[model samples]
Target: MKFTTALITALFSVGALAAPSITKRQDTVTYKIHDFTERKYNGVNISTLFFNIESPPNSGGNIKFECAPFVFPTGKTSSTFEAGHVYFCYKDSPYSFSFVPGDAQKGTWAKLNLWQTDSKTKTYVGDVEFREPPCRAAGPGKDTVCEAQEDYQIHMSVAGSPTEK
Candidate 1:
């Protein structure tokens, strides 16, 4: 009985030591509007938000924020950005963003993956083409309006939790 008990304890100890340790970290990132442009199209407003990653000047770093163009249908005058519509450019790098889903005014949770394909898959294929939309806003809100882009100062926050092993 004593030998059997010792063997079982040793096996359990070895198994515990072989197991990998996992740690989870939650982080929130805030990005500022470095540049932006808005234009009216078919009675609807189209806006493109640009953010420049902070890097040493003259470093030749190619870090950039790549995002799909966001269209604000008629009656969308909140000036707040929609969730799951922005992506960071880095060789199809995978990233996740957590934010308030629907109406920013409503309390809802939404998560977005940069390389999300279909409903439940993310594929990191290759380089992504970067296309910066044109800036043009005829009247009304001037901040997003390219005519007064110098005064633009909007900050957006994205929260994400990643597991580390």
Candidate 2:
């Protein structure tokens, strides 16, 4: 009985030491848009904009955008308006702005678009667009090389206003 108990305890100790604990951190990113250009449209100044987006660590092989209007020229007479379609690019990926409005389907890809807030709910308005990465032809009889390529870009952008939750 003593021998069996000692062996069991030793086995348990070895099992505990061999076990590995893996912790997964959540990847949530923040995006901002700025550098609004004032253009004369019908004698009125319209805002043309650019964006800066920060990707969270461990982006989970994807980028997400939530669109909403922002309060500009803050305090007393802060103007709010709906911004138009935004654009993004990833340096590591070979994807283009080929995303369409819809959920992800097989071979379907997407990116985020920022919009204005809804007056009633005080929530930002926006939609997600799916897109596919650009394709490249492999060298003669070299399918393995083309198939192994991966995306590595690390930046994204929009046309007007910042988008967040």
Candidate 3:
């Protein structure tokens, strides 16, 4: 029968070009804490939000998202505050993160890098709209105040595995 219908349409076009369309994207990341040091961090302080994502020939892997929970007041800090919804890649390269009030876990994880709003799309996906470096307290007894929590900014949606390079 025409070689079994052309070998079942060339095996469904090589299984849709070698499969790799796994996806899951959610957004709502906003964490802002500015403690000019009076030394408080006592009333409410819990943190963990690291999200560094790079999508090149690395193609996306099995990743998931959604993490939220924060309330650090008493020392005071807020440029905004929603902080949550960040998933990570499975095999590697996609440090998605989230934390707050977590048992025995208290503040420190402000890594940033997940930017690529639109470079044209080959599809690995990364995007950050938060910029830092206005001269963050560097002198004078410094230690300033921006008490980690992955230092804030993450909300992307990109999947991987289409014969990843």
Residue range 1-165, candidate 3, lDDT tens digits: 999999999999765534333344333222222211211122223222222222222334422222222233423332233344343322222233332212223334323333222224433333333322122343345322333323333444443533222
Estimate the TM-score for candidate 2. 0.20
Best by the TM-score measure: 1
Per-candidate Cα RMSD to the true structure, in Å, reads 18.7, 20.1, 17.6
Error of 2 at 115 (Å): 10
Summarize candidate 1's per-residue lDDT along 92-151 as a digit string, tens digits. 323322222222335432222332221233222211112223344455655334322332
Q: What is the lDDT of residue 132 in candidate 1?
A: 28
Cα displacement (Å) at residue 81, model 1: 12
Clashing residue pairs, backbone N/CA/C < 3 A, model 1:
38-136
Q: What is the TM-score of each candidate against the true structure?
A: 0.27, 0.20, 0.21
Please identify which of the two predictions, 1 or 3, would achieve the higher TM-score against the true structure.
1
Worst 10-residue lDDT window, candidate 2: 142-151
lDDT of 2 by residue, 1-165 (tens): 999999999999765433322123223223332221222222222222222222354743233332122332342211222233332222211121221322235654434354322223233333343342322433343221111123223333222336332
